[model samples]
Target: MTYDLGVDLGTTFVAAAVARPNQAEMFTLGDRSVVTPSVVYRADDGELISGDAANRRAVSNPERVVREFKRRLGDPTPVMLAGTEYTVSDLIGAVLGDVLRKVTETEGEPPSRVVLTHPANWGPFRRGLLEEVPGMVGLTDVGLITEPEGAAAHYASSRRLTDGELVAVYDLGGGTFDATVLRSGPAGVEILGMPEGIERLGGIDFDEAILSHVNVVGGGALDALDRRDPQAAVALDRLRQDCVLAKESLSRDTETVIPVFLPGRQFEVRLTRSEFEDMIKVPIESSITALTRALASAQVTPADLSGVLLVGGSSRIPLVARMVSEALGRPTVVDTHPKYAVALGAAVVARAQRGEQALTQRRTDTAAEGGKDADSPARGKTDGSTRSRRWPVPVAAVVVLAAIVGVVLAVPHIVDSGPGSGDQTAAALAPISNTPPLASAPIPTAGSPLPAGATPGFAAVSPNGRLLYVANGDAKELNVLDTTTNTKLATVPIPAGPPQFLTFSPDGGRLYVSIFDVSGAGSEIAVLDTSTNQVLGQVPVAGQPYRPAVTADGRGLIVPVHNPESVWTIDTVSLKVTGQTPVPPDPSWVELSPDGRKAYVVNRGANLITVLDPASGKITGQVPVGAAPNAVAVNPRQPLLAVVNFNGNSVTLLDAGTDTVTTTIPVGQHPQAVAWAADGQFLYVVNDGDNTVSTIDPRTGKITATVPTAQTPTSISVLPDGTRAYVTNLTSGTLTSLNLTG
Candidate 1:
């Protein structure tokens, strides 16, 4: 009949939950939704309204409605709703009161204990106003917890955390962005450093960007509408709602259309995910920079953290996750329901605080039997009561009171507390699946294809991660697979010798395939127009071409060859061999830096990697690696490179800037190829002898997992989002797809 409750007073939306022992349930607020809009409206009769009612009435009576008051917590000015002024505190308190009333009505009684969550960077002025909210709502036993701490506590309640492990929390909500660092130990999750935030960046801003694009496409029709006209105002409001829907659709779809309605004109604007990403990349990048600063201020590195926890509805953007992973060089995780994490975590904290207080009181009552005193050093004051637990929060002002929540150690077997819970605990929750889950298209059965003698050699993914190109040696053809559908889209026949390795232009418009001659007579480089899925032509060369790479500018191609042991640079425009430089024997693979300033060739016979100048075909530096370095991979975001040694069974990491070896890691036997997860968070090496792929953490130099594959896995291509990888098997003549989801 009694339970602890937690509330997240967010900027655009509010969420609440009630906790009882091991389980917590989210309250279905206005209109049976788990979350309620933070908007408030005052009627002409001096009646205050909130949530869905306020949202529906705002368009007709815009002057009577006010929203997003949380952002003005410390402002001296008051917001006017229907000619009546109210402080930010009063607005927030009304939102909280509505949420509490809903929960109480559902349970037929008010909650026994309450806890609220707020941004970590809020100073004394803002926090003090929040401290008065519980009293305003007629709640007595209320405590406050920082938003980041609440998120971390929720993460720890599910995932196992070892003592002293650090974790970073990235919270991007509807109207604000926050970054924080936390450490887990015997006590609980503790704040590691000052939390950082960007006040004006979040999902709402992204919606505005989409709206602006719509306006531009519609010839500023939206801006031309008159706000004084009642019909125009309604149309504008409807358009904004449409824009929000389009933005959410773009997250799961490749493209969407936003319908625009004006006073006299109406139109629809088509938007693609790529275009949306470009528009918001700057602000998202800025958030990553803030996250890096948070880690630095905590005196820790990305390698020091077990993982990064993404919290809030905005963090679900696919671009956000990919950018965070690549920028941090660490694994990033998003809970099943990021929007409700703070509320559920607050509930956990509320329950733990009550449990600890009760246990401490029982001990105090039995102090005669050798129990510690009530005023022992372990006992701390929370809500003027003794709680033998401590929660450390960060603050710059001495008078800013930081309340600790989420003592996870006191929780035993906590359930998921998520929406629609049914015998599932938080531990059972899985990471967010790819926007469109990868379909299990049946691979070729025994007698499906006609290429009987084909043996797949190498595979490559396009820049957009839509198409996969696999080179077949015996069949002398390229098999194109549509990654989204997980099915073969088409096949391009090779004109000359069997294709060994495949590369794509930076723009993903052209495909370059290295044709290898089996008789050691001669070879050529075959070019394919990706748009048409047809071979354009082949450039005849003297020696055997093993693998080739296209320059960043897409104007030149770099190829490493055997027999004569030389590297060739061909002008892509003229299709002519512009320059050839002699190198050590058996130059098997070649790669160019992102800026096209340097080229690296892995010479299998020389047992080292050779650096060269692509412009003049001149040798610049030779970094010694393990024996028989067969492949090299350049990190997409960082100045790092990895080389796989076939004979030595090791991988050598190099600093691309200085051309020096940073470290060498031991891997499985007979590693054939190495690929960097687009984020550079993980390095994957395909072991031919072991028939498995070893996932190596570049930061720790430890093999995190070994995934079994088809026999003799030769090459791998990880998708741009780092969700899946395609591997080519030499013996089986088949391709293996590995799920790389974290």
Candidate 2:
């Protein structure tokens, strides 16, 4: 057979289609079905089984099966089957190969041309990983197409699209949501602007939401089901499958019953379509907001769009279509088989590729069009032929420094820049202290601003350096201080327990407060809206969460926890725990390299630092530091990391690039916290035992200044302009402002 083929390797399902003269025909990969489960199982014989066979085998040997490997592409972490490790590419290649084998068997030959569809918001890194799949499947000269472009192509294949007409695509898939706008051009449908995506918002989230509702209605019976029981896992699996069926049944029917099977109990819960709609309303609204932002980024109004095209399995919900139409006030078109739309559309693109014509134009490398993070610096323009661009560090630093200088004085500032597409180093202004300006500089203290018996623990500054948030552990609240005046602006009450640690979003729009486990009520992370300082919601953790680090992408949080000896990954979009990675004991703090690819965790009990990939939570390497490592920080401008040793009274410096110990420098007694200066020239160590802050020149490995602070200075927050630093004292319940510009 000499047909062109398109394959959609989705998170939950896989679909394939072939292009004929004027139409695309879907391939039946399942028993009388057009799609197959995207799952793979490693049998005892070491042979890989996929689709329905794998799905069935997983019931008894769940440990050997892998699902949703599509979402883990680009992650260096590998999935372990029994004793063997399988890379994400290997798993995807297996499923893709299965699809290819079936299609080839039916047609009596392999397809001449093959095309694969991926999420529109995928940067070059992920796209590059997907580009390797075809070669592994014994296919050559394969093409790649964005999912939205494929859907738009399939839509245009049946209907005539006028030139310059704009159409929007709202793709809510199993694991992610992508919102993109495209325009009809001479060549094909071209993306108009940067696509907006919610990486954790999709059908899987809705399924979780429904499962949560089940737990609530079942009087927490599901929660009480002991997972340690051998039958519990299988019961829960079947319950989840029932939930998926119930969710789908409600799409056409008004109500459905979900059968719940626990270890010792079995029951059915009635669910109405209205209840299901209510459960998913908020996330659907979030998707609509993404669509609106995409249109705004394209500089076009909703009225200018020819119509809104809905694709993906999740987009078939009636409520989704209704909300899209109401939100944009435009006609919405839902595909008859939304799940297979991307696959069919890929066939269209594949046929065009076979003719030496690129149906869709690649986006130019620019600030708005290319796949750059929102905080990334502007990139040079391209001719819309290439898919990648190199991001220079100096150029990024110039842009980041300019933004910081515009907000603060014309002084060096450490702006925590987000990670760019691929291998783009985050830009931060280095503190150029060629001359040690201060020797034994003293700081003024803001004596106990709160009521008596209040213990302040941790502190952080906003990105703009306008506000400082102080966690009052004893008071069970967060004290907001105006940095200009060094006075209290407001106090926001903590929800569940005393606030233990505090961190802010990169944009300063939200603040995350880790709450202690009070009276065995369990711990949680309280989320607050910075604009109003009001508690928005809370994400429950399995154990007491220590200091959490927000990922460079700003879409997830890496939380180090105690009691269970694991780190949790929280998707910021849904405020839900997505994954857990086990680590050494007593993980206290987490720090990310400026580039954000690696996360460094300080294991206080183990006296070592564990380095892991932030995306996959897979441990990459480890560095042994001084005794009782309490805190860690990465230099903004250099490839250096500083780890504070509480018991050893020293700071261990490591090379962030190689994860190797560079040197160790002596400091004051009980150095509990460490921070890099704005220009990356100085290191600040907060000594809890000595109640002093030691300023060390890392280049010389000598203390430049030792300034007295409030009693038991436990945390430090340096201002963005490198002019001052604030130290929070736990015993004195006050803040000491140190002058660094002298």
Candidate 3:
């Protein structure tokens, strides 16, 4: 019998699967059915031992046994095992080899193909290691699939999903968490988005917590036990083993007894479900935050989902399953064996690759047949005749030949097509047009009649290059301007309270406005439908929402709250407060990078810009800016970051590729808002206090022009064509439109 294999090289455990003619099954190496604990022991003779053998040896030679090698997959250091130095890939290869041997033994034939699973967040370097490991085991034709994608594929295949259905895959493994949004279609599975969770967290964190609890109850002798003191080390190791068992047992029980053995004392401690939940509360919350962010990034809601599938062994914990269900308000599907699902899916993929089981072919039969016959003389003759014949040839031959040629050309065109084909074409052909019509446009000159005592704070044109939403602070309403006709479409009233900031959804269907209530009790976000110019709903926000940013998918909105040092995520569809993430104190503004992969938050209090992952709501990196970072902007065409410092009177430029501040250039005092010129050559910063706009050449990071504005210009917004810049002057109570193109 021939076999195809699937392997999941997990942090704490390794799983493998085999698929045959009519059966597909997953089994761990060395006698385990679902998973083989990823433990390796080094023998004195420079030999490596895995599986049950490694576990048995760990009791006698604890130092020689490595339990968490997967955590260091990206590390360059080699681990010494049995007097031999082995890289992470070596260990993984050994595990894979062992599994392949098992499959060969069982089927009497080596597997023809293999599929490997990896974390979605694994970057190029880590992915390289994953790709290299299989080669060490003689598996050359291996397909690498994301862990969450594998799980989602399994769910989709099992449920026989039709077109246009989305699935959110939450993978909480031993050392990492990842959530991916996928849509299953007739073509196959398409990955909509993937927001990764805390990479440093997993089941091992809970194990450590349980171990710490055991130590706390054991009168704080954990340090002694960890050092492996002859008497205490054995007791500590046994206690750790017990803690692990208890943690797993708690998955199905309300309470479990953890036994600890010491030199002269032996004790059993009863751990309750509530206590365990409390112990893991922080991690659970983090997971929920990641899930929420993923959904937000996908611009999807729980109600939009067909189902939520739980993957990874760590998700088996009752608390994890319960928290996911409670937070999403969707019934969680936890019936599948989390550890084996990925491997099983991989094996299925492997079998499909081997062409044993007939899955939907990615290529159409006509295309495949055309490809097969392309080199044949008969086909060549037909092609030559078609090219030589005129359009008025025999009706049947004309149709058939034309269809063949069209298919050949269409296949290549379809293969090269991508998400932004239409947008790119339109942008290439469109001419520059920045000015709005008289009726919808803001008056170019100052001293124009104010709109019913309205204090205009800022004006932003919608991304689609259509309407402009102007925040009228004094009038307590938003002035909607039509760009095409340059006319005011309508004025939508905003409830009076605190200063409000506005942002538009990705699709420009809705507008998000953050307002501070009168009592300072909290802030509220008002949602408006752009099509109707009507207020849809308002939800309370924590802290004072200063700069609001709608996620790229438009499902979630992020608003930076000053003073309280946090940012709140509002669910746009449900109009509910979903999650809150803490940021640096006194964050002045927040802007999403062009790719929508990261959020750059300027912290005036800390004089730094924190790079946050919007999906996971986690701070990934930070860069020191000027004295007080007041504004941040990202170039849409290039990997460049521009930051304006309120106190330093300088603009700091960053090369995003290296995450380093490349240069700094002096600008006007209190530069607040920065915008990129359409050509990406010039960056404009509004120096509010200086009443001037400083234009800097991004290539040289030098000041290019300093144009005076009305007194106390608060903000500056540029049209898509970059011909005019609308500056909001608070003191003058006027909008200044600068003719930059001229």
Candidate 4:
């Protein structure tokens, strides 16, 4: 059987995507790893090794290495590798050949038609080189796809955009940064204009920043040793590799310790996230600038774009996402799996190319027999949920787009024969518009929570996304909605007065609610069986509870009581009170880390946040915050916490590692609740006083946007896919849905 294959022949790394039946499966090259370093090296016995093996030996055998040859493409210069003078094209072909060989071994056959992605900014000169390199590696039939288009295909595959909508592709890969704008229509993605590129900037640049910081902070330790030792080159090479790991580490960690060791020298240094950001700030800014230029070139503004799709592994950098979104004033959509998105997109391209070619041939045959014109609109096939069709891709337009996009449109009978047999046909598939045009998002939309004037405050989404549990301050019951239809599913009455906060256990089997102002009830904790919306039991408490958090183990429901100024832990399995830990006065909010090792609680009266050990129910540490701190959140991926201050009108960022405030960022008036976006890179604070939601960058401690909401948005929650953010109004009884396409 023939396979549809896409190869992301990146400069620093190589990723392959093979189209199977329904999904595009990604495969590793050279080694059994998802990503292989795109480097080729010769060993002492003259055997060629690439990827991790080549990268590892580079530190000890620098003379035999050739890395990042993609940067040198289009140049005819022949560089000496080992004992042979191989051109940049030759080296790339070798890498491409290895990738193809590995794929053949896995798939039992070579790809019938290959889709090779290249940097969008490449012109005919450079593109010609890339185009011919694939054929040289024995892949006779190849379709050239821009790196940005490949990334766009990945975004489009999710069926999110409307037909003919403009979307920008912001690619920050391991070795390069590229920004391209494309318009998705019935005829697939057309180049918005031209592509913009940063020829030598990417994650590698960030690694260099760490190296430079080491030179300055290490106090000449690395540099002095580099000059004296015969293996200094190898030592510096090893340091570069270590720096790459450190840079990636900072993505999920606030700080990491760098250990510099030699045969007789050893030193350990602490590098903070802020310091690393400072070093790479300039290069990171360049990527944002390139995105701006690409937008301008496309004759489109930030507001005109549907969204910015950020792909490539380097995009994992918290700084890159924040900066690009800030510069474009657009919601940047980070690829869920950045490294493989491009390769997966390639497979989509291959399928589209083959299908279009087949459909086009059919049209031509029909046109000759008194049938519809070949240039007519494409025939479509829809199934209510998805819309896919083959639009007419004129031969002329195909030629023009191919040249501009580094693609060689394979129009069998129309175009001149170039690669493979002249009769061989390929697909030039149209862009499938999956979702209908999105209507203007309505803010301040009210939902009729039961009990008439009961005000909806906070909501929790089931882990499976099957149900949305909405809580209110005056309602005596919990309102449940089927997330698929956004309608009331069931309302369960509670034992407490009004539910103020709702949370689900990690397993999503049990529901926990924090209630306040119960007339006869001393405690305000309610637990329910989600399978039937039946009340399981209520845990007795001594004070009014404001927020509820489930421990990492899903065994304890931690509730913070305001009046009593203590946190109570209820054993979920036993359905009884476990223990209570005393904190500062008016402790209103609580959040646990991803690992569930510790709990962060906000004490409003003392203007501080206390860290508690869940297992022992004891205060471990306290960090001073703004006045009247109300809501607190910890980024599960990073050791950072965002604490909202009601009285001070600011959010203080705390590094959980040190239990200290790194920066306090001003926000909208009377910030009530704060929650992290999908990836935990940004925080959304609902400002009750101003009736707006502030998007905050937890890494930089800055507010990016203050979107107006319905009256008194008390709490917020983002969907699992980061597509939507629901904000509940405390007084208006409305649920504001924000289109968070990013």
Q: What is the C-alpha lDDT of each candidate?
A: 0.72, 0.73, 0.65, 0.68
TM-score of 1: 0.52
Residue-by-residue lDDT tens digits, candidate 2, 1-742: 4798999888888999999767798999987578998989998988888998898988877777888777666544578986799998889889988999989888998887888887665555466677887899788878776677667767777777666777767777787666555665554444554443444556777888889999999999888987766588778777888888998999899999998878768888999999999888755754554443455456678788767788889888899899888977889888888898889888877776665332122222333575544354333211122223211111000000001111222211222211111111111112221322111122222222332136878899877665678888877777775453343556666757889888888877778888885452558988887766667789988788999999766899999999789899999889999999999999999988888889999999999999989888899998899999999998877999999999999999998888999899999999999888765767889999998888887877888778787688899887765546788889987777765533
- Candidate 1 achieves a global lDDT of 0.72
- lDDT tens digits by residue: candidate 4, 1-742: 6678999989889998887647677886645678798999987886677777787788777878988777766443576888788877877887888888888998898876678888654544466677789877778768776676677777677755566676666687877666555666655655654454545667876776688788778777666774545477676777777888888899999999887765466776689889888877755653543343355445666777766677888888788778767766778778889988889888877866766666767888888886867676443211111112222221000000111011112222222222122122112111221211111111212222222136787787765444567775665666665432344545566655777778888767777877777553555577776765666787767778778788767888888886577888888889788788878898888898777878888889999888999889988888899999998887745788889999999988888888888998899999998877655656788899999888876655666677887787888876553435677877778777664421
Clash pairs, candidate 2, are 430-679, 431-679, 431-680
Local error of candidate 2 at residue 214 (angstroms):
1.6
Cα-based TM-score, every candidate: 0.52, 0.56, 0.52, 0.50
- Cα error, residue 325 of model 2, in Å, equals 1.1
Q: Which 10 consecutive positions of candidate 4 have the poorest summed lDDT?
A: 395-404
Alpha-carbon shift of residue 146 in model 2 (angstroms): 0.8
| lDDT of each residue in 386-492, candidate 3, tens digit only | 11211110111000000000000111112112222222112112222222211111112122222212566777776555456677776677666433223354666
Once superposed on the true structure, which residue ranges of model 2 sit more than 4 Å away at CA? Answer: 357-742
Name the top TM-score candidate: 2
Give one digit per residue, the lDDT tens place, for model 1 in 38-110. 8998888876788998898997877778877887675545788778999888888788888888888888999
Model 3, runs deviating above 4 Å: 77-85, 226-231, 356-742
User: CA RMSD for every model?
Assistant: 18.1, 17.9, 18.7, 20.5
Give candidate 3's error at residue 263 in angstroms: 3.1
